[model samples]
Target: MKVTNVHTRRIHQPKEKVSKLFKTLATTNDLIWPYENWPAIKFLEGLNVGSKGGHGSIRYTIIEFNEDDYIKFQFSRPEGFMGTHEFKIEALNENQTEIRHEINIQTTFETSLLWIFVIRWLHDALIEDAFNKVENYFTEAKKKATYNFWVKLLREIYKRKPLQTKIA
Candidate 1:
């Protein structure tokens, strides 16, 4: 397995908003790349759902999803190998949330020499870029959402806050 690129971003949004964003990413395929319905099953041709499509569900077949605080997935291509991607969310403050994305690639290359070469070349070049793109997408989305939320909040506060009292 090789560790590619990892990106972390802090979004200035409430915990609830952050959770909603995460949930949107987790449950909605429209927000993700290679856009396709039933992505998990479509990508993993012969896989079966180990449990119901909810928290702690184990995907035994080609693709799998498990929701334990964070939503994680494991997928395998035609090659006899698999990769795992996980997203974690942490509440930083009343108006900030932290998101971390981790990706691991495991291939069937048996020889250490081949593994090292692939890790150094393919991983650094292709896999890292792919993960970075995904991270950038989420980061941009979160930023936009956070900005909108704060703007609206400020507007509401400005409209509601009483005018400053004049000193005698």
Candidate 2:
């Protein structure tokens, strides 16, 4: 089964700032901790790291990575099935970046079928919600003092109205 989605937004921070955020978000340990805290995070406890970071082996697994571009990893779950998650990042502008996440499930017929059902359920109920949480984090980060210039400009743009004009 294949699941893919793309979400894009204009961030107030420069590409460097956004890149740092993406790097933090993409790291295995960083990503894992949030999951560790949430109830859903516990679902993939035993899945070894396989390969981590850029071209590094993780949990004895071989994963692919493109420096500062993307990362992909594959692992088997407790149910004896394989799955993969890929993350891609792109710079849209000096002050904006795009992040994309893709998920794939590979397994035997019986296991795949079971996972298909569960994955769909989780995608609809939990994964989507998790992505929203990530989006919120980006939004909040853009509002910080470091991003004051962009935020102030945006606020000014919002306050100006073409409809406000003097009538004779």
Candidate 3:
């Protein structure tokens, strides 16, 4: 099955400032990923091409990285996820910017079932939470994204399992 997914948000801040926050992705000082509410993205060799890491049971390797533009990761785990997912910073204006997360992949039957039944809902919630984290950074009033019923149920079920904390 071929899948194409995208999530984007416009921030009322300059691209430069938003890009600075993106630079902290997967880092100790990460300012974008909603690690407090979800699994944190980790890279053994940091944010550069060839670095390997991922959140939860999914895994990937960085295929491209541009400090002020975007970072793309090619999936290598959760068998049958063939392709890439990336986060891009687009300047909409001198004082506004858009943060986009896109996924393009072809999944095998098993993975397709997983994606449709579980991953899709979880992925949507995760991305929205990440966007909220970014938007929360530049405003006095913070934004929070709520998970849907399916997402809440999925999270509850997944919480019963032990989480992986280190990347190998």
Which candidate leads the pack in TM-score? 3
Give the alpha carbon lDDT tens digit for every residue of 1-168 in model 3. 999999999999999999999999999999999999898899999998999999988899999999999999999888899999999999999999999999999999999999999999999999999999999989899887777799999999989974665676
List, residue by residue over 36-114, the lDDT tens digit for candidate 2.
3223222122223343222111121327666476656665342444666666667787766666666665567776674
For all candidates in order, the CA lDDT equals 0.42, 0.44, 0.93
Output the lDDT of residue 116, model 2.
58
TM-scores for candidates 1 onward, in order: 0.43, 0.50, 0.97
Give the winner by TM-score: 2 or 3.
Answer: 3
On TM-score, who's better, 1 or 3?
Answer: 3
How would you order the candidates by TM-score, starting with the best?
Answer: 3, 2, 1
Better of 2 and 3 by lDDT: 3
- Across 32-145, the per-residue lDDT of candidate 1 in tens digits comes to 222221122122221133322211112223134333236555533324345665666677888876766665666564633444643233323322333343445546542212
In the predicted model 1, the residue pairs found to clash are: 47-61, 47-62, 48-61
Worst 10 residues of 2 by lDDT: 52-61
TM accuracy, model 2: 0.50
